[model samples]
Target: MAERKATNKYYPPEWNPKDGSINKFVGQHPLRDRARKLDQGILIVRFEMPYNVYCDTCKNHIAKGRRYNAEKKSIGKYFTTTIWSFSMKCHHCSARIEVQTDPQNRDYALSKGIHRVLAEETKNDTVTSTYSMTGDEKQDEMRNDPFKRLEHLQEDKEFADEEKVHLIDLLEFRDRLASADYQNNSALRKSFRVILGLLLQNFCKD
Candidate 1:
């Protein structure tokens, strides 16, 4: 006699679809502890290239406004608290840099880079008049600015040629803003929209 085609004829009713497989569902994952792959135990974290920092090895610029691969490592623990440090490598020179969270001062300190660049902190904001986004929400807005690739203030031949950004603030504001000093000592005299435009400019440093 011809053998009957093999099939799941003897499969358990629970293993067959529409045969009450839903009740037998087990919440198991194909992968284990996926968050641990990110770093430590945090599933999500943020790291920024804060300044137009120069690579020590190649003297190339690792400019601000871009995200890089970062590793977070715990240095110590105070009772139940832990100190974390964010480590980054210069894409150009492979020079390593670090910034650490200082819970005592409630600030961050960079161990290996010249200075930090203050970046825009805006977005397709809704309900600004009635309710404002705060903290991480506000920050997320700026980081995702839609016009960051548009014209840049740093591209102004007048300003780019004369001014330099420094640790505390602009290094040569006297010269950089001299032309606009009469306009209330402002380096920029444009409208609020223009101000927003200036803040989001992506000045590529290559």
Candidate 2:
């Protein structure tokens, strides 16, 4: 029964050893149902959401890492790399969503039926609760208040001057350490150690 089951694959009347592989003779793809649209150059695949997106038709939120059965096909090529497209349906509203590979940017782009959720939208509000001013807030304050902008400019100038002084001090310290006399002393000490070790070995042998 096992042997019969193993050999249960159907073969058409024209099928023969000389005709080629069994899949070619049977007019079926090796991937079976996954290649149902092989004639159209598309294949069924399991695709995961690359990032958060909102369904345009139903306004439903699709989180990143969500998996779906998608249709995949090579749409074009960027140099030697082929760009692929994935088309899937949203679980909540059954709305279609299409995403394509952006080979140049090394990311995915939404082709249709969906909108991406921005990083700022997904960020927690509590993250900015601290009193320290962020770059954006500082820039906004500087733009609105001339006095604040002038103060910031003065602070920047002071900081740059301090950095320059520190850099000059470091260069002086480096120059002192790398002096010709220092290099000669270092080499002399290294040779003295080698000579002392050889003398100690001879004394021990004697």
In TM-score terms, which candidate is top?
A: 2
Q: List lDDT for all candidates, in order.
A: 0.56, 0.86
The TM-scores of all predictions, comma-separated, are 0.33, 0.48
- Model 1 spans with C-alpha error above 4 angstroms: 1-46, 77-81, 113-206
Instruction: Write out the backbone clash pairs for model 1.
Output: 122-142
- lDDT of residue 92 for candidate 2: 92
In candidate 2, stretches whose alpha carbon ends up further than 4 angstroms from where it belongs are: 1-19, 119-206
User: Model 2: per-residue lDDT, tens digit, 1-206?
Assistant: 88988886766777797988898777777898999987898999999998788999999899989999999999999999999999999999898899999876556888999877875643232245534545666788999999999999998899899999999999998888777777879899999999999999999999
**Taking the tens digit of each residue's C-alpha lDDT, what string does model 1 give over 39-67?**
34433245876445555566666666668
Candidate 2 Cα RMSD (Å):
14.8
Q: How close is candidate 2 to the true structure, as a TM-score?
A: 0.48
